[model samples]
Target: MHFDLADLRLFIHIAESPSLTQGAKRAFLSPAAASARIKALESQLGSRLLYRDNRGVDLTPAGQRLLQHARLIMRQVEYLKNEFTAYGADAAGHIRIFANTTAVTEFLPEVLAGFLAQRPGVTVDLQERLSRDIVRGVLDGSSDLGIIAGPVNASGLQVLHFSTDRLVLAVPRNHPLSTLKHVKLKDTLRYQHVGLHEGSTLLSFLREQVEHLGETLSLRIQVSSFEAVCRMVETGVGIGVIPESAAKRHSRTMDLTIIELDEEWAIRERSMLVRDLDALPGCVRALIDTLLPASGAEPPSNTPT
Candidate 1:
Protein backbone atom coordinates (compact mmCIF):
# COMPACT_ATOMS: atom_id res chain seq x y z
CA MET A 1 0.00 0.00 0.00
CA HIS A 2 1.20 3.49 -0.85
CA PHE A 3 0.23 6.59 1.20
CA ASP A 4 1.77 10.01 1.03
CA LEU A 5 1.29 13.62 2.27
CA ALA A 6 -0.51 14.51 -0.93
CA ASP A 7 -2.98 11.66 -0.38
CA LEU A 8 -3.49 12.70 3.25
CA ARG A 9 -4.10 16.34 2.35
CA LEU A 10 -6.52 15.43 -0.44
CA PHE A 11 -8.37 13.09 1.91
CA ILE A 12 -8.61 15.70 4.65
CA HIS A 13 -9.98 18.28 2.21
CA ILE A 14 -12.62 15.88 0.91
CA ALA A 15 -13.62 14.86 4.41
CA GLU A 16 -13.99 18.45 5.55
CA SER A 17 -15.81 19.94 2.56
CA PRO A 18 -19.53 19.92 1.80
CA SER A 19 -19.01 18.07 -1.48
CA LEU A 20 -16.27 16.17 -3.26
CA THR A 21 -16.13 18.80 -6.04
CA GLN A 22 -15.50 21.58 -3.52
CA GLY A 23 -12.85 19.55 -1.75
CA ALA A 24 -11.08 18.91 -5.01
CA LYS A 25 -11.21 22.62 -5.84
CA ARG A 26 -9.72 23.48 -2.46
CA ALA A 27 -6.95 20.99 -3.07
CA PHE A 28 -6.29 22.54 -6.53
CA LEU A 29 -7.19 19.29 -8.29
CA SER A 30 -9.78 18.56 -10.94
CA PRO A 31 -12.87 16.77 -9.59
CA ALA A 32 -12.20 13.78 -11.89
CA ALA A 33 -8.56 13.69 -10.84
CA ALA A 34 -9.52 13.89 -7.15
CA SER A 35 -12.06 11.10 -7.56
CA ALA A 36 -9.43 8.83 -9.16
CA ARG A 37 -6.98 9.63 -6.27
CA ILE A 38 -9.60 8.78 -3.66
CA LYS A 39 -10.44 5.49 -5.41
CA ALA A 40 -6.75 4.64 -5.55
CA LEU A 41 -6.32 5.51 -1.85
CA GLU A 42 -9.32 3.36 -0.97
CA SER A 43 -7.94 0.44 -3.00
CA GLN A 44 -4.52 0.74 -1.37
CA LEU A 45 -6.06 0.75 2.12
CA GLY A 46 -8.55 -2.03 1.20
CA SER A 47 -11.49 0.01 2.53
CA ARG A 48 -14.17 2.36 1.31
CA LEU A 49 -13.38 5.87 2.55
CA LEU A 50 -16.49 7.79 1.55
CA TYR A 51 -20.07 7.49 0.39
CA ARG A 52 -21.19 9.73 -2.47
CA ASP A 53 -24.71 10.72 -3.45
CA ASN A 54 -26.46 13.43 -5.48
CA ARG A 55 -26.27 15.90 -2.55
CA GLY A 56 -22.67 15.49 -1.37
CA VAL A 57 -20.17 13.06 0.15
CA ASP A 58 -20.07 11.60 3.64
CA LEU A 59 -17.26 9.68 5.27
CA THR A 60 -17.66 6.00 5.96
CA PRO A 61 -16.36 4.50 9.24
CA ALA A 62 -12.98 3.86 7.71
CA GLY A 63 -12.95 7.36 6.25
CA GLN A 64 -13.73 8.88 9.65
CA ARG A 65 -10.83 7.00 11.23
CA LEU A 66 -8.52 8.05 8.44
CA LEU A 67 -9.68 11.64 8.76
CA GLN A 68 -8.69 11.69 12.42
CA HIS A 69 -5.17 10.51 11.69
CA ALA A 70 -4.80 12.65 8.58
CA ARG A 71 -5.71 15.77 10.53
CA LEU A 72 -3.22 14.89 13.26
CA ILE A 73 -0.45 14.33 10.76
CA MET A 74 -1.16 17.69 9.15
CA ARG A 75 -1.09 19.42 12.54
CA GLN A 76 2.20 17.79 13.52
CA VAL A 77 3.71 18.87 10.22
CA GLU A 78 2.58 22.46 10.79
CA TYR A 79 3.97 22.39 14.34
CA LEU A 80 7.29 21.08 13.10
CA LYS A 81 7.49 23.90 10.59
CA ASN A 82 6.69 26.49 13.23
CA GLU A 83 9.29 25.06 15.60
CA PHE A 84 12.00 25.38 12.99
CA THR A 85 10.95 28.55 11.15
CA ALA A 86 11.02 31.03 14.06
CA TYR A 87 14.77 30.95 13.86
CA GLY A 88 16.61 29.31 10.94
CA ALA A 89 17.29 25.58 11.12
CA ASP A 90 17.40 24.25 14.67
CA ALA A 91 20.91 24.25 16.07
CA ALA A 92 22.37 21.35 17.98
CA GLY A 93 23.06 22.28 21.61
CA HIS A 94 22.38 21.64 25.25
CA ILE A 95 19.90 23.66 27.29
CA ARG A 96 20.69 23.92 30.99
CA ILE A 97 17.52 24.55 32.97
CA PHE A 98 17.07 25.02 36.70
CA ALA A 99 13.47 24.52 37.75
CA ASN A 100 11.57 24.34 41.00
CA THR A 101 10.14 21.17 42.53
CA THR A 102 6.67 21.48 41.00
CA ALA A 103 7.91 22.01 37.44
CA VAL A 104 10.60 19.36 37.72
CA THR A 105 8.42 16.64 39.24
CA GLU A 106 4.94 17.11 37.80
CA PHE A 107 5.09 18.88 34.44
CA LEU A 108 8.54 19.11 32.89
CA PRO A 109 9.04 15.40 32.29
CA GLU A 110 5.99 15.06 30.05
CA VAL A 111 6.58 18.41 28.36
CA LEU A 112 10.22 17.63 27.68
CA ALA A 113 9.47 14.14 26.37
CA GLY A 114 7.56 15.40 23.33
CA PHE A 115 10.04 18.20 22.63
CA LEU A 116 12.99 15.82 22.81
CA ALA A 117 11.27 13.29 20.57
CA GLN A 118 11.13 15.77 17.69
CA ARG A 119 14.55 17.35 18.11
CA PRO A 120 17.08 14.58 18.64
CA GLY A 121 19.92 17.07 18.23
CA VAL A 122 18.97 18.79 21.50
CA THR A 123 19.73 17.67 25.04
CA VAL A 124 18.62 19.13 28.36
CA ASP A 125 20.33 19.18 31.72
CA LEU A 126 17.43 19.70 34.07
CA GLN A 127 17.98 20.21 37.80
CA GLU A 128 15.50 20.97 40.54
CA ARG A 129 16.37 24.13 42.39
CA LEU A 130 14.45 26.54 44.55
CA SER A 131 12.75 29.46 42.75
CA ARG A 132 15.24 32.01 44.00
CA ASP A 133 18.16 29.82 43.10
CA ILE A 134 16.66 29.22 39.67
CA VAL A 135 16.40 32.93 39.14
CA ARG A 136 20.00 33.44 40.27
CA GLY A 137 21.17 30.68 37.94
CA VAL A 138 19.52 32.33 34.94
CA LEU A 139 20.92 35.68 36.02
CA ASP A 140 24.51 34.53 36.54
CA GLY A 141 24.73 32.43 33.35
CA SER A 142 24.63 29.20 35.32
CA SER A 143 21.64 28.04 33.22
CA ASP A 144 19.90 29.01 30.00
CA LEU A 145 16.50 29.29 31.74
CA GLY A 146 14.46 28.31 34.75
CA ILE A 147 10.88 27.36 35.63
CA ILE A 148 10.12 28.99 38.94
CA ALA A 149 7.25 28.93 41.44
CA GLY A 150 6.36 31.35 44.24
CA PRO A 151 7.65 34.92 44.47
CA VAL A 152 11.09 36.39 44.62
CA ASN A 153 12.56 39.55 43.20
CA ALA A 154 12.94 38.17 39.67
CA SER A 155 14.02 41.65 38.59
CA GLY A 156 16.70 40.84 36.04
CA LEU A 157 15.20 37.73 34.45
CA GLN A 158 12.73 37.56 31.54
CA VAL A 159 9.64 35.85 32.93
CA LEU A 160 7.09 34.01 30.81
CA HIS A 161 4.10 32.75 32.80
CA PHE A 162 4.36 28.98 32.88
CA SER A 163 1.84 26.60 34.42
CA THR A 164 0.04 27.21 37.68
CA ASP A 165 1.32 25.11 40.56
CA ARG A 166 -1.59 24.51 42.90
CA LEU A 167 -0.76 22.22 45.78
CA VAL A 168 -3.95 20.56 47.00
CA LEU A 169 -4.77 18.10 49.74
CA ALA A 170 -5.84 14.59 48.80
CA VAL A 171 -8.10 13.10 51.44
CA PRO A 172 -10.07 9.86 51.63
CA ARG A 173 -13.62 10.30 50.33
CA ASN A 174 -15.22 9.81 53.76
CA HIS A 175 -12.56 11.66 55.74
CA PRO A 176 -13.74 14.58 57.88
CA LEU A 177 -11.76 17.13 55.91
CA SER A 178 -13.31 15.96 52.65
CA THR A 179 -16.33 18.10 53.42
CA LEU A 180 -14.21 21.24 53.45
CA LYS A 181 -13.22 23.01 50.26
CA HIS A 182 -10.06 24.46 51.72
CA VAL A 183 -7.83 23.66 54.68
CA LYS A 184 -4.75 25.61 55.72
CA LEU A 185 -1.49 23.72 56.08
CA LYS A 186 -1.19 24.73 59.74
CA ASP A 187 -4.63 23.29 60.51
CA THR A 188 -3.78 19.97 58.79
CA LEU A 189 -0.41 19.55 60.56
CA ARG A 190 -2.07 17.89 63.55
CA TYR A 191 -3.35 14.99 61.47
CA GLN A 192 -1.24 12.03 60.30
CA HIS A 193 -0.13 12.26 56.68
CA VAL A 194 1.21 10.28 53.75
CA GLY A 195 4.24 12.05 52.25
CA LEU A 196 6.75 11.55 49.45
CA HIS A 197 9.96 9.81 50.49
CA GLU A 198 12.87 11.76 51.93
CA GLY A 199 15.00 13.78 49.52
CA SER A 200 11.95 14.40 47.35
CA THR A 201 12.24 18.03 46.23
CA LEU A 202 8.62 18.84 47.03
CA LEU A 203 8.83 17.14 50.41
CA SER A 204 11.89 19.21 51.33
CA PHE A 205 10.08 22.39 50.25
CA LEU A 206 7.02 21.44 52.31
CA ARG A 207 9.23 20.80 55.34
CA GLU A 208 10.55 24.34 55.12
CA GLN A 209 7.01 25.80 54.87
CA VAL A 210 5.83 23.87 57.92
CA GLU A 211 8.99 24.71 59.81
CA HIS A 212 8.10 28.39 59.31
CA LEU A 213 4.98 27.78 61.42
CA GLY A 214 7.03 26.08 64.16
CA GLU A 215 5.40 22.74 63.33
CA THR A 216 6.26 19.65 61.30
CA LEU A 217 4.40 17.24 59.05
CA SER A 218 3.34 14.17 61.02
CA LEU A 219 4.22 11.68 58.30
CA ARG A 220 2.93 8.28 59.30
CA ILE A 221 4.04 6.69 56.04
CA GLN A 222 6.56 7.65 53.38
CA VAL A 223 6.20 6.68 49.73
CA SER A 224 8.44 6.90 46.69
CA SER A 225 6.07 8.88 44.45
CA PHE A 226 2.83 10.84 44.26
CA GLU A 227 0.78 7.87 43.02
CA ALA A 228 1.90 5.81 45.99
CA VAL A 229 0.93 8.59 48.38
CA CYS A 230 -2.49 8.74 46.72
CA ARG A 231 -2.82 4.96 46.97
CA MET A 232 -2.06 5.14 50.68
CA VAL A 233 -4.56 8.00 51.10
CA GLU A 234 -7.23 5.91 49.33
CA THR A 235 -6.72 3.18 51.91
CA GLY A 236 -7.22 5.74 54.72
CA VAL A 237 -3.56 5.63 55.72
CA GLY A 238 -3.46 9.46 55.83
CA ILE A 239 -4.14 12.50 53.74
CA GLY A 240 -1.44 13.81 51.41
CA VAL A 241 -0.54 17.17 49.86
CA ILE A 242 0.24 16.86 46.20
CA PRO A 243 -0.13 18.69 42.90
CA GLU A 244 -3.77 19.16 41.86
CA SER A 245 -2.94 17.70 38.45
CA ALA A 246 -1.65 14.48 40.01
CA ALA A 247 -4.52 14.31 42.51
CA LYS A 248 -7.16 14.72 39.79
CA ARG A 249 -5.55 12.02 37.68
CA HIS A 250 -5.55 9.58 40.63
CA SER A 251 -8.98 10.60 41.95
CA ARG A 252 -10.80 9.14 38.94
CA THR A 253 -10.07 5.54 40.00
CA MET A 254 -9.41 6.03 43.72
CA ASP A 255 -11.75 6.95 46.54
CA LEU A 256 -10.16 10.32 47.00
CA THR A 257 -11.12 14.04 46.90
CA ILE A 258 -8.99 17.14 46.47
CA ILE A 259 -9.24 20.05 48.90
CA GLU A 260 -7.49 23.30 48.20
CA LEU A 261 -5.04 24.61 50.75
CA ASP A 262 -6.08 27.87 52.37
CA GLU A 263 -2.74 29.56 51.93
CA GLU A 264 -1.25 32.00 49.44
CA TRP A 265 1.54 29.58 48.76
CA ALA A 266 -0.93 26.92 47.67
CA ILE A 267 -1.55 28.77 44.39
CA ARG A 268 1.36 30.28 42.49
CA GLU A 269 2.19 30.94 38.88
CA ARG A 270 5.12 28.93 37.58
CA SER A 271 7.03 31.16 35.16
CA MET A 272 9.76 30.39 32.63
CA LEU A 273 12.79 32.60 32.97
CA VAL A 274 15.59 33.51 30.61
CA ARG A 275 18.17 36.23 30.81
CA ASP A 276 17.48 37.44 27.28
CA LEU A 277 14.76 36.09 25.02
CA ASP A 278 16.03 38.00 22.00
CA ALA A 279 19.55 36.68 22.39
CA LEU A 280 18.55 33.07 23.00
CA PRO A 281 19.84 30.18 20.89
CA GLY A 282 17.47 28.63 18.33
CA CYS A 283 17.20 25.40 20.29
CA VAL A 284 16.28 27.27 23.49
CA ARG A 285 13.71 29.30 21.55
CA ALA A 286 12.19 26.13 20.08
CA LEU A 287 11.99 24.49 23.48
CA ILE A 288 10.14 27.53 24.85
CA ASP A 289 7.69 27.48 21.92
CA THR A 290 6.90 23.79 22.47
CA LEU A 291 6.34 24.21 26.20
CA LEU A 292 4.00 27.17 25.73
CA PRO A 293 1.49 25.75 23.30
CA ALA A 294 -1.36 27.94 22.03
CA SER A 295 -4.04 25.80 23.63
CA GLY A 296 -4.42 26.15 27.42
CA ALA A 297 -1.86 28.99 27.33
CA GLU A 298 -1.79 32.55 26.07
CA PRO A 299 1.21 33.95 24.18
CA PRO A 300 3.45 35.18 26.96
CA SER A 301 3.43 38.97 27.34
CA ASN A 302 6.65 38.70 29.25
CA THR A 303 7.75 40.82 32.22
CA PRO A 304 8.30 40.12 35.90
CA THR A 305 5.23 41.18 37.85
Candidate 2:
Protein backbone atom coordinates (compact mmCIF):
# COMPACT_ATOMS: atom_id res chain seq x y z
CA MET A 1 0.00 0.00 0.00
CA HIS A 2 1.16 3.57 -0.70
CA PHE A 3 1.93 5.88 2.22
CA ASP A 4 2.90 9.52 2.69
CA LEU A 5 6.02 10.69 4.52
CA ALA A 6 3.95 12.10 7.38
CA ASP A 7 2.26 8.76 7.92
CA LEU A 8 5.59 7.01 8.02
CA ARG A 9 7.08 9.61 10.36
CA LEU A 10 4.13 9.17 12.71
CA PHE A 11 4.51 5.40 12.61
CA ILE A 12 8.24 5.64 13.37
CA HIS A 13 7.68 7.99 16.28
CA ILE A 14 4.95 5.81 17.72
CA ALA A 15 7.07 2.70 17.39
CA GLU A 16 10.03 4.36 19.14
CA SER A 17 8.12 5.71 22.15
CA PRO A 18 6.53 3.33 24.64
CA SER A 19 3.28 5.24 25.01
CA LEU A 20 1.06 7.17 22.65
CA THR A 21 1.28 10.22 24.89
CA GLN A 22 5.06 10.30 24.64
CA GLY A 23 4.84 9.97 20.86
CA ALA A 24 2.30 12.76 20.78
CA LYS A 25 4.56 15.00 22.81
CA ARG A 26 7.46 14.33 20.43
CA ALA A 27 5.28 15.09 17.40
CA PHE A 28 3.81 18.19 19.12
CA LEU A 29 0.25 16.89 18.72
CA SER A 30 -2.38 16.50 21.44
CA PRO A 31 -3.04 12.99 22.71
CA ALA A 32 -6.48 12.91 21.05
CA ALA A 33 -5.14 14.12 17.70
CA ALA A 34 -2.27 11.65 17.74
CA SER A 35 -4.60 8.77 18.55
CA ALA A 36 -6.95 9.84 15.75
CA ARG A 37 -4.13 9.93 13.20
CA ILE A 38 -2.94 6.48 14.22
CA LYS A 39 -6.48 5.16 13.92
CA ALA A 40 -6.89 6.70 10.46
CA LEU A 41 -3.67 5.12 9.25
CA GLU A 42 -4.71 1.76 10.71
CA SER A 43 -8.05 2.01 8.98
CA GLN A 44 -6.41 2.76 5.64
CA LEU A 45 -4.00 -0.15 6.06
CA GLY A 46 -6.78 -2.48 7.37
CA SER A 47 -4.60 -3.82 10.18
CA ARG A 48 -3.92 -3.22 13.83
CA LEU A 49 -0.56 -1.43 14.00
CA LEU A 50 -0.12 -1.35 17.76
CA TYR A 51 -1.11 -3.27 20.88
CA ARG A 52 -1.56 -1.53 24.23
CA ASP A 53 -1.86 -3.08 27.70
CA ASN A 54 -0.19 -2.65 31.12
CA ARG A 55 3.28 -2.40 29.46
CA GLY A 56 2.18 0.54 27.36
CA VAL A 57 1.84 0.47 23.53
CA ASP A 58 3.95 -1.69 21.26
CA LEU A 59 4.02 -2.23 17.53
CA THR A 60 2.32 -5.33 16.18
CA PRO A 61 4.17 -7.77 13.89
CA ALA A 62 2.89 -6.04 10.77
CA GLY A 63 3.95 -2.70 12.20
CA GLN A 64 7.52 -3.99 12.60
CA ARG A 65 7.67 -5.05 8.95
CA LEU A 66 6.20 -1.74 7.76
CA LEU A 67 8.54 0.30 9.94
CA GLN A 68 11.57 -1.14 8.13
CA HIS A 69 10.33 -0.04 4.74
CA ALA A 70 9.12 3.25 6.15
CA ARG A 71 12.62 4.03 7.37
CA LEU A 72 14.16 3.25 3.95
CA ILE A 73 11.58 5.38 2.14
CA MET A 74 12.10 8.26 4.53
CA ARG A 75 15.86 8.07 4.02
CA GLN A 76 15.50 8.30 0.26
CA VAL A 77 13.28 11.33 0.63
CA GLU A 78 15.91 12.96 2.81
CA TYR A 79 18.60 12.15 0.27
CA LEU A 80 16.60 13.86 -2.42
CA LYS A 81 16.18 16.96 -0.28
CA ASN A 82 19.91 17.06 0.42
CA GLU A 83 20.78 16.72 -3.28
CA PHE A 84 18.51 19.61 -4.20
CA THR A 85 19.68 21.67 -1.30
CA ALA A 86 23.26 21.23 -2.46
CA TYR A 87 22.31 22.59 -5.87
CA GLY A 88 21.17 25.89 -4.36
CA ALA A 89 24.58 26.55 -2.84
CA ASP A 90 27.74 24.61 -3.49
CA ALA A 91 28.66 22.52 -0.45
CA ALA A 92 25.65 23.91 1.42
CA GLY A 93 23.72 20.77 2.41
CA HIS A 94 23.11 19.15 5.75
CA ILE A 95 25.23 16.08 6.51
CA ARG A 96 24.10 14.10 9.52
CA ILE A 97 26.69 11.67 10.88
CA PHE A 98 26.87 9.18 13.75
CA ALA A 99 30.28 8.25 15.18
CA ASN A 100 31.76 6.33 18.05
CA THR A 101 33.64 8.06 20.88
CA THR A 102 37.08 7.49 19.39
CA ALA A 103 36.05 8.48 15.89
CA VAL A 104 34.46 11.72 17.11
CA THR A 105 37.16 12.68 19.59
CA GLU A 106 40.22 11.63 17.56
CA PHE A 107 39.37 10.94 13.93
CA LEU A 108 36.65 13.30 12.72
CA PRO A 109 37.94 16.69 13.89
CA GLU A 110 40.75 16.87 11.33
CA VAL A 111 38.60 15.51 8.51
CA LEU A 112 35.70 17.82 9.31
CA ALA A 113 37.96 20.78 9.82
CA GLY A 114 39.27 20.36 6.29
CA PHE A 115 35.82 19.53 4.93
CA LEU A 116 34.20 22.64 6.39
CA ALA A 117 37.13 24.75 5.26
CA GLN A 118 36.57 23.56 1.71
CA ARG A 119 32.79 23.65 1.87
CA PRO A 120 31.98 26.58 4.08
CA GLY A 121 28.28 26.45 3.31
CA VAL A 122 27.85 22.83 4.37
CA THR A 123 26.82 22.22 7.97
CA VAL A 124 27.48 19.01 9.85
CA ASP A 125 25.25 17.53 12.53
CA LEU A 126 26.94 14.80 14.52
CA GLN A 127 25.67 12.21 17.01
CA GLU A 128 28.10 10.34 19.21
CA ARG A 129 27.25 6.80 20.27
CA LEU A 130 28.95 3.46 20.67
CA SER A 131 30.30 1.78 17.54
CA ARG A 132 27.42 -0.68 17.34
CA ASP A 133 24.83 2.02 17.89
CA ILE A 134 26.48 4.17 15.25
CA VAL A 135 26.11 1.31 12.78
CA ARG A 136 22.47 0.96 13.73
CA GLY A 137 21.96 4.68 13.20
CA VAL A 138 23.35 4.43 9.68
CA LEU A 139 21.29 1.33 8.90
CA ASP A 140 18.11 2.87 10.32
CA GLY A 141 18.48 6.02 8.18
CA SER A 142 18.84 8.24 11.20
CA SER A 143 22.32 9.22 10.03
CA ASP A 144 23.56 10.01 6.54
CA LEU A 145 27.03 8.69 7.37
CA GLY A 146 28.82 6.83 10.13
CA ILE A 147 32.41 6.20 11.27
CA ILE A 148 33.21 3.27 13.51
CA ALA A 149 35.78 0.67 14.50
CA GLY A 150 35.56 -3.08 13.64
CA PRO A 151 33.79 -4.85 10.83
CA VAL A 152 30.18 -3.99 9.95
CA ASN A 153 28.04 -5.92 7.50
CA ALA A 154 24.68 -4.63 6.24
CA SER A 155 22.61 -5.57 3.19
CA GLY A 156 22.25 -2.33 1.21
CA LEU A 157 24.86 0.06 2.59
CA GLN A 158 28.44 0.31 1.32
CA VAL A 159 31.46 0.20 3.66
CA LEU A 160 34.77 1.89 2.85
CA HIS A 161 38.03 1.74 4.72
CA PHE A 162 39.32 5.22 5.45
CA SER A 163 42.14 4.32 7.86
CA THR A 164 43.71 1.61 10.00
CA ASP A 165 44.65 2.04 13.67
CA ARG A 166 46.77 0.10 16.08
CA LEU A 167 45.18 -1.13 19.31
CA VAL A 168 47.66 -0.55 22.15
CA LEU A 169 47.81 -1.39 25.84
CA ALA A 170 48.00 1.58 28.17
CA VAL A 171 48.98 1.69 31.84
CA PRO A 172 50.02 4.36 34.29
CA ARG A 173 53.53 5.67 33.53
CA ASN A 174 54.91 4.12 36.68
CA HIS A 175 53.38 0.69 36.10
CA PRO A 176 55.87 -2.18 35.69
CA LEU A 177 54.80 -2.77 32.09
CA SER A 178 55.72 0.81 31.24
CA THR A 179 59.44 -0.01 31.12
CA LEU A 180 58.91 -2.71 28.54
CA LYS A 181 59.16 -1.93 24.84
CA HIS A 182 56.57 -4.56 23.93
CA VAL A 183 54.39 -6.54 26.29
CA LYS A 184 53.54 -10.21 26.03
CA LEU A 185 49.87 -11.12 26.36
CA LYS A 186 50.58 -13.13 29.53
CA ASP A 187 52.45 -10.27 31.19
CA THR A 188 49.68 -7.79 30.39
CA LEU A 189 46.94 -10.15 31.62
CA ARG A 190 48.71 -10.61 34.96
CA TYR A 191 47.51 -7.18 36.02
CA GLN A 192 43.93 -5.98 36.47
CA HIS A 193 42.37 -4.84 33.19
CA VAL A 194 39.95 -2.05 32.40
CA GLY A 195 37.50 -3.15 29.75
CA LEU A 196 34.54 -1.83 27.82
CA HIS A 197 30.99 -3.07 28.32
CA GLU A 198 30.18 -6.61 27.27
CA GLY A 199 29.08 -5.97 23.68
CA SER A 200 31.66 -3.40 22.74
CA THR A 201 33.74 -4.42 19.71
CA LEU A 202 37.03 -3.30 21.22
CA LEU A 203 36.44 -5.37 24.33
CA SER A 204 35.31 -8.34 22.28
CA PHE A 205 38.50 -8.31 20.26
CA LEU A 206 40.73 -8.01 23.30
CA ARG A 207 38.82 -10.65 25.20
CA GLU A 208 38.94 -13.06 22.30
CA GLN A 209 42.64 -12.57 21.87
CA VAL A 210 43.22 -13.12 25.57
CA GLU A 211 40.97 -16.15 25.59
CA HIS A 212 42.86 -17.64 22.70
CA LEU A 213 46.01 -17.28 24.76
CA GLY A 214 44.50 -19.48 27.48
CA GLU A 215 44.19 -16.64 29.96
CA THR A 216 41.24 -15.27 31.85
CA LEU A 217 40.82 -11.52 31.58
CA SER A 218 40.53 -9.86 34.98
CA LEU A 219 38.45 -6.75 34.52
CA ARG A 220 38.56 -4.15 37.27
CA ILE A 221 36.09 -1.75 35.64
CA GLN A 222 33.91 -1.48 32.58
CA VAL A 223 33.33 2.04 31.34
CA SER A 224 31.60 3.26 28.21
CA SER A 225 34.09 5.86 26.97
CA PHE A 226 37.81 5.58 26.32
CA GLU A 227 38.34 8.88 28.12
CA ALA A 228 36.96 7.31 31.27
CA VAL A 229 39.23 4.35 30.79
CA CYS A 230 42.24 6.68 30.50
CA ARG A 231 41.23 8.60 33.62
CA MET A 232 40.97 5.40 35.57
CA VAL A 233 44.36 4.27 34.31
CA GLU A 234 45.83 7.56 35.51
CA THR A 235 44.62 6.84 39.05
CA GLY A 236 46.14 3.31 38.99
CA VAL A 237 42.68 1.77 38.82
CA GLY A 238 43.67 -0.57 36.00
CA ILE A 239 45.50 -0.72 32.74
CA GLY A 240 43.24 0.16 29.79
CA VAL A 241 43.52 -0.92 26.18
CA ILE A 242 42.43 1.34 23.36
CA PRO A 243 43.45 2.65 19.96
CA GLU A 244 47.02 3.92 19.84
CA SER A 245 45.90 7.22 18.37
CA ALA A 246 43.58 7.87 21.29
CA ALA A 247 46.25 7.06 23.86
CA LYS A 248 48.71 9.47 22.25
CA ARG A 249 46.12 12.24 22.19
CA HIS A 250 45.58 11.82 25.93
CA SER A 251 49.29 11.54 26.76
CA ARG A 252 49.57 15.20 27.81
CA THR A 253 47.23 14.93 30.80
CA MET A 254 46.77 11.19 31.19
CA ASP A 255 50.44 10.43 32.01
CA LEU A 256 49.79 6.93 30.76
CA THR A 257 52.38 4.52 29.36
CA ILE A 258 51.49 2.77 26.09
CA ILE A 259 53.07 -0.25 24.46
CA GLU A 260 52.38 -2.28 21.31
CA LEU A 261 50.52 -5.55 21.66
CA ASP A 262 53.10 -8.16 20.64
CA GLU A 263 50.43 -10.55 19.47
CA GLU A 264 49.50 -10.91 15.81
CA TRP A 265 46.11 -9.23 16.00
CA ALA A 266 45.23 -7.42 12.84
CA ILE A 267 45.08 -3.66 13.05
CA ARG A 268 41.60 -2.20 13.42
CA GLU A 269 40.06 -0.50 10.43
CA ARG A 270 38.50 2.92 10.80
CA SER A 271 35.88 2.90 8.08
CA MET A 272 33.17 5.11 6.66
CA LEU A 273 29.74 3.68 5.96
CA VAL A 274 27.34 5.34 3.54
CA ARG A 275 23.92 4.28 2.37
CA ASP A 276 24.68 4.50 -1.35
CA LEU A 277 28.07 5.45 -2.74
CA ASP A 278 26.89 6.51 -6.19
CA ALA A 279 24.08 8.60 -4.75
CA LEU A 280 26.34 10.79 -2.58
CA PRO A 281 25.86 14.55 -2.73
CA GLY A 282 28.62 16.86 -3.97
CA CYS A 283 29.70 17.84 -0.49
CA VAL A 284 29.84 14.16 0.47
CA ARG A 285 31.88 13.46 -2.64
CA ALA A 286 34.29 16.21 -1.68
CA LEU A 287 34.66 14.82 1.82
CA ILE A 288 35.20 11.33 0.43
CA ASP A 289 37.89 12.63 -1.85
CA THR A 290 39.63 14.26 1.05
CA LEU A 291 39.44 11.20 3.31
CA LEU A 292 39.97 8.33 0.89
CA PRO A 293 41.69 10.09 -1.97
CA ALA A 294 43.82 7.25 -3.34
CA SER A 295 42.18 4.33 -1.55
CA GLY A 296 39.12 4.21 -3.84
CA ALA A 297 36.79 2.48 -1.37
CA GLU A 298 38.92 -0.24 0.24
CA PRO A 299 37.77 -3.15 2.37
CA PRO A 300 37.61 -3.00 6.18
CA SER A 301 41.19 -3.98 7.07
CA ASN A 302 44.16 -6.04 6.00
CA THR A 303 44.98 -7.19 9.53
CA PRO A 304 45.75 -10.89 9.45
CA THR A 305 43.16 -13.19 10.91
Identify the candidate with maximal lDDT: 1
User: Against the true structure, whose TM-score is highest?
Assistant: 2
Compute the lDDT for candidate 2: 0.77
* Candidate 2, 1-305: lDDT as tens digits: 66767878877887899888888888888889888988988898898999977777988888887787788787677656766763453376768888766676665788789778877678888777666677777777777788877777666667777877878888998898889878777788889998877666677667778788888999999998788889999999999888887888888776889899776663677778877766666666667667675334553443322
TM-score of every prediction relative to native: 0.66, 0.77
Instruction: Give lDDT tens digits, candidate 1, residues 1-305.
Output: 55789989999898889999999999999999999999999999999999999999999999988986776566446435545653345545568889866677777899889887887777789987766678777765667778876665767767888567689999998998989998999988878999987766678778999999999789999987788999999999999999888889889888898999998888867678887786666778888887888225676876644
> How far out, in Å, is residue 228 in model 1?
2.3
Off-target runs (Cα >4 Å) in candidate 1 are 1-88, 199-201
* Candidate 1: residue 58 lDDT (0-100): 99
Task: Assess candidate 1 and give its lDDT.
Answer: 0.81
